[model samples]
Target chain A: MKLTNSMEGVTIVETEDIKAKKPVVLCGLPDIGLIGIIAVSHIIKELNMKEVGYVDSDIFPLIVVFHHGEPTYPVRVYQKDNLLAIFAETALSPESVHPLSKVIVGWAKEKNSSLLVSLGGIGVPNRIDIDTPRVYGASNSASLRESIKKYEIPVMEEGFLVGPYALMAKLSMHSDLPNLLLMAESYPQYPDPGAAAAVISALNKFVPVNVDTKSLIQKSEEIRLNARELMRKTSENMQKMGKSQEYELPLMYV
Target chain B: MPAQKRMPIEPADTWSYGVMWDHISGCLEPLTEFHDKETELMIRIDMPCVKRKADVEVNLTEDTVAIEAKMNRVVQYEKWGTFQREAKFFRYSKMFTLPAKIDPDHSKARFKDGILELHLPKKERRYSVKVE
Candidate 1:
């Protein structure tokens, strides 16, 4: 935990306890709202990256220098305009997407990321809010689409995206850096183990991990039941409308 | 006494009995206003995990607008008090009051990326004739 005189309250986050590897994948999202935060944490644990020093937000240009052991690949930290940006061969944890996706994508392109995939979720109505969640995928890059298509993950045909997902799409387009977004339907505004399980499934196809999803399934009911009351209000808000439901493959458990 | 700013209309307590517990609450920051010659309203919502457009649902009324967006389920690591789904969201639901009557059939909505935008057109106003 290091503070810098560069800027005011910007705290840079990196990790230790990792396996050095290349072609690293990084994730971010809209805000502390989506489960990207959790995805990143799992990525950190799955990949096991050594923690470098903190990069103060005040620093110009995204530069992540480890005060300790040198990282496998160079990581940079700074801001892209007002958004907080970080670039590393290593990915961050908790995968929380923030408004800074625009910033981070730029950093990824600079590092010439072979591929960048941002994982996130959406809350739905008219469903059981089950433990086994399904996932969908989208890509601004054709290669990404081709690789992910074998999994039979649905492609995003339409819709609006904001914050990190939106920015990541835009930056990748501008830089010609291929980016894909894998989203799973989750409980609105509450933690969802089911959605996380779906992400882990998709990531496993690419990131290569040894973690077991069986453990996460147990947390499904725990998290789903945990938010029953608040979900009731959301239910009331949704009842005014009527429509059919959508489905994804099982990611968590029955 | 100092005057404090007033917040927009709060979500009604007894919302439709539907299973609304899926969505978190007011996460996507809404826009300041949506206006056309016929109608105008303010909307801002956050749907963190939506990968494609087919995952959301929207409905509108003369005085109300209800939205249901499916959040991609991602577990957040730490308890940050407000967020749960991977810290992005569980779901997002918000209702709005229209300044004028709206034609639900004539309105339009678009969700690109993860944000959902709704365009509601106002119903024509009828002048009341007073007989003296």
Candidate 2:
């Protein structure tokens, strides 16, 4: 394992020696509704993935998270078989987003990852009236787009995507890596575990993961209540990143 | 040692002092959003774990709104943090000072999917003037 602590800002460190053949990289960064974080955390818990590494940076929050009687970094990497997930337990500041995205894509490129999937949520005004939130897909690769179509997930044709996942998508566009984003319609300010469940179900269709959404649905209320503080902090960060732009239409539809 | 440089402070950034829970009352502040429209100001509050709509209580005035909801069951946190231990929460409560004066008599509310939406009509009406 090559442990390179970059001088640029963010560093991806490998605490345990890991070797996987063309692993699939999954990102569960904090965003609107805390969708990605919730989904990835559930996946990590259900699959019993092991923590192999963590992300360290001076720009990150100056706090350590204690889990299961052990102190861990806010952002950590977990692995189960060929699946690799980067999960962030705390809300990231807006300034650290660019360098973090760069480091993640660069590391994925170095690993020769098969695909990079970003799980997130899209805020919708009428989310209260909808029982089952719909998931949308966007990819930089043609084959992935075909796969999305094959899976019958709606494609996000045109709109502004603002946040870390958006930056990762743009950065990976210039590289050979294939990046895919799956976002579910969710509440703008509240933690929506239902939306996270929807995204996970959608991801299960393409990714080789056997996970059920029934437990997620049954414990939706508890998840929302437990995730309140993170959602509040993430909402404030979203305001800093101009997340409302996602609601605006593209200037040129053609 | 070199002095650390601090980021510029903005008004909105300092608005929240980061206190959203009360240990004594065992009540939490729910996530809320406000939208200012042409005629009415809309406010939405997310109250998860609230089983029935009747359990929610809303009190409105000309320029303020208060909401309280009872959870379906008491939730116990074995470890909330280093400072808090075995905390129990049974309700959600919050109050907001509105941006504009609202006609409390004409305001409407709807609760669905654990979300409470309130439509408050502005007290002052806009009149179209004839151009000479």
Candidate 3:
């Protein structure tokens, strides 16, 4: 197999279902990588789609393949007459995300992705603990915005996301693909399945995926407690070395 | 330097992790409840984030009680950003080693008004029953 330094205009990962029909792209990074992963994975599992392949990368942001395993990116596709592409990635350092722009743009073009949606989380202090997370929506095209607006979700007022997901949103706009980003009130610094579930609820309108929402809601405490313990260990380790992993937490505006 | 000056600018213990968690331990509210029959063990989870009871997950086994929630947070916004990039989520996970044996097969769980309640049926207490 030949390799490329970056996301190529054509896919190096061959499709086993090439002759089946048009494809809907849905992706996720998993609940651990970022908050968005849980959302995208929820859609994928709820939709009962097949595990195709992954865009492998051993870089700072890991992207491994899946056969019968969990997805890492909260970005995926639910196929129908209209294809929906979910753009979800762990919100990490900006420099580490530059490659995302290159790869996703190429992937979108090569895959002919028509509609793209990037789901993000905006951390808020007050949202540290709650049941029903709130979400806001935005789009690359006005019509796409209208589509999401039909659900009465709040528009992503005035803010920015800087990473592969954001890059894809920007690239999709210029690439002729109608793109959008649905952001939620997330503890950007923490693994927020609640936020992810909320965003997924808002998104179920377009792609039509069915998620029970019960499991995600029920497991919230377990998720929080585990996260707390992890943080305690990390904080202790950081202190012992007189250093910190600043990149471990999410950056929320609220 | 005086004792006051000797304090570190940021205490590591004060931080949950180097990343710091969103839900504060102090903010954690107490969750306790009572049940009627000997069959149900009233379970009250402190979830200020969840709005609807339908979003909670509860599972019971012969000797275990597993519950999960993606609780919602009361949201507010402020516009001060120190970084312009990605986010890290401190996911919540708590595994409670139950103190009693529970009926893993037959159990009732409900989420009402943001609170998740589980009625874990105690085994036939074979001793708690009588016949005429």
Candidate 4:
């Protein structure tokens, strides 16, 4: 049962019939520290999610990632229970981000998703000195803000967010769909598994996933080593997106 | 879009899989960054899997910095991601050319959380001259 979804010039090809009931859509695109990607990847592996769909666009890079013995799309969709995650194995070009975000939000709206969450990292200069990275939250809706407050997650007070998650937040503002961003303090250049683990722990408080973060912490070194190339590529994209603006203070007086 | 033109291909030696691990040396290149500050130039290198500070070595000069560290154990990946090859890495090695010359003698280094931070004082110091 293959279903094709085309919107804003980006198509999502679902290979299997998805029977999720108001699924919570999660996005884990490549960004600083590869935090979101690592966290979402761990959840997918722990839950043994099945790859049911994939995304394609002309503006995307011309490449395919080989996992095990099969070649798969660089950007793919995986599902487990009511959890649907969109994971990116390769870096997204700056030009493709707008269309991709629009399509994802539109698809979420079409699915009548209960909530949409975007996991990412906030680059902190003193990450080396910090033992455990802190997770911060931002949302486009007031109810989601209350949920974040109830979870005791710090609200992102004043700063510019630049990347895929930033675009998602902006586009979801017009729609009734709530968009939540969980960003952990992370190293700007290197892949920070500690930061990923921190965000995962924070996300578990509200999301349905009950993932054990012990293995993630124990295998931090291995994850960092294996993700070096991806991290390097993500860093290049971050530079192009002016990711350093995240550290700058916003000029909002009110 | 206009008809795409066929571009000339580069040599095969330059067509790398973009992997961090070097097959010949069995060493991975650690991610590193350099910050050129006013008084000192700081270089931070991320070298995970390196357990003890004794196993890490750093060589600093006025214009360059070299680092090598041994992992706690040999890391083996039978089919690592896209680069389908069985390989083992024992250490992490990397070197960088500095953007500005520094006083190596006054440089200081510290290792924490598997990250090595080197602070090299710039040789040319700025004096606060009164504007007349």
lDDT winner: 2
How many residue pairs in model 1 have overlapping backbones? 88
Ten residues in sequence with the least summed lDDT for candidate 1 chain A: A237-246
Clashes of each: 88, 0, 63, 0
Cα lDDT tens digits, model 2, A129-195, are: 8889999999999989999999999999888999999999999998778999999999888988899
Q: Candidate 1: where is the Cα deviation over 4 Å?
A: A1-22, A30-33, A53-99, A127-131, A219-254, B1-132
Per-residue lDDT of candidate 2, residues B14-119 (tens digit): 6434657665578878878788899998888888889798999999889888888999988888887765478888898877777788999999999987889999
DockQ of each: 0.03, 0.66, 0.03, 0.71
Clashing pairs in 2: none
lDDT tens readout by residue for model 3, B9-72: 2354453232323333212222323333556555544454556555555665665555555546
Model 4: how far is B31 from its true place, Å? 0.6
lDDT of 1 by residue, A99-176 (tens): 235445644554456667777776653113254567778888777787778877777766555445656778788878
Q: Could you estimate the TM-score for every candidate?
A: 0.45, 0.93, 0.51, 0.93
Worst 10 residues of 3 chain A by lDDT: A10-19
- Tens digit per residue, CA lDDT, model 4, B1-132: 111112123246356645566755678888877788889888888988898899999888788777889998998888654456787888988777777788999999999878999998989868898999
For model 3, how does the per-residue alpha-carbon lDDT over A72-125 read when each residue is reduced to its tens digit?
Answer: 432222333334334333333334344655665566556665555666665554
Complex DockQ, candidate 4: 0.71
CAPRI class assigned to model 2? medium
- For model 2, the stretches where C-alpha displacement exceeds 4 angstroms are A1-7, B1-16, B130-132
Instruction: Note the Cα lDDT for every prediction shown.
Output: 0.49, 0.87, 0.50, 0.85
Q: Tell me the alpha-carbon RMSD of every candidate.
A: 14.6, 5.7, 18.0, 5.0
Which is superior by TM-score, 1 or 4?
4
